[model samples]
Target: MYLYGASGHGKVIAEIAEELNISITGFIDGNADIESILDYRVIANNADGLEGKAVISIGSNKIRKLIALRDNQFDYVKLISKKANVSKRAIVEEGTVVMMGATVNSDVQIGKHCIINTNASVDHDCMIEDYVHISPNVGLAGNVEVGEGTHIGIGACVIQGIKIGKWCTIGAGSVIIKDIPDYAVVVGNPGKVIKYNEIQKLSQ
Candidate 1:
């Protein structure tokens, strides 16, 4: 399998693949200048005509979504690290990456092309939509709903039954105790809405 995006994120994915004994053909990068990562050759500026499975390996939810939507040729694979504690009852869709030390509890529904980053804890009955990024050490309580393209930053904690809307950004170390609206940029202990992401709104 090939990992798209030759960066630090891609290196993590490569490590996970190695842990699973999966053979990596190389990396596929948009930047021509990036020749290699972890001694693996990088195919620059072209995903076309590449056979076999691939993982996006991008940290950015928006970029990951855009690449998945734009490049439909390669078969996208869901990557779950061997060290991850994923419940059998969880439904993780294709193109999603569950990183090492992550814990996904029962009845969690994680959508396509999502990132459940290292050591993240997603409690039971959570619904994580497509392109969502649950950053390292983040915690989501039971029944928390994270909408499409939303990014929950590192070490952030969301309370039970909270609904985080689409394209929202929950800042690092934020404590979310209430429902977040669409395109909102939230931060602080109570996770106040610092601003709406006008750039994301305009892109849509």
Candidate 2:
């Protein structure tokens, strides 16, 4: 399989794949100067277009990951770390990576290009949408639904059945007890929205 992006996150993804005994083709980062970071060679801009599987392997939820999939028809690829414990009944879609020590319980449905970082625990029946990033040591209770492009910061916790909306950012160590709206920036204990995501508007 081919891995996209040669940044620090890409290196981690590469390492995880190696540990899992998956065949890695190479990386495709926009920055072409990345020669041999993590002892992996970067192929270049437009990824080699090889006739094989590929993973986004990115960690930046701030920049929407769907952008990388535009017009590309590579089949979805799901990767679970060898050290992670994922229930066989759980449905993890392509372009998703479950990092080391992460535990995904039964009935969990994780969407494309989502990152479940190291030591994160996702309870049973949770729904995580596309491009969502669950940071290191995060925890989500049962039945929680994380919307597209949402970012759960490191050490954050979300109560059961809470609906975190699209592109929302939950700050580190925040405890989310209520539903969060799309594009909201939330932080602190009992997490509350601090600001709206103005970056999308600025880009438009």
Q: Per-candidate TM vs. native? A: 0.97, 0.92
Candidate of highest lDDT: 1
Candidate 1 residue pairs in clash (backbone atoms < 3 Å): none
RMSD value for candidate 1: 1.2
lDDT of each: 0.94, 0.84
CA displacement after TM-score superposition, residue 34 of candidate 2 (Å): 1.1
- Best-matching candidate per TM-score: 1
Residue lDDT tens for model 2, 30-143: 777777667767776764445567788767764436545562666657788999999998999878899999999999999888999999999999999988999999999999
Q: On residues 78-138, what C-alpha lDDT tens digit does candidate 1 reach at each position?
A: 9999899999999999999999999999999999999999999999999999999999999
| Model 2: pairs clashing at backbone N, Cα or C within 3 Å | 77-94, 95-113
Off by over 4 Å in 2: 62-64, 199-204
TM-score of 1: 0.97
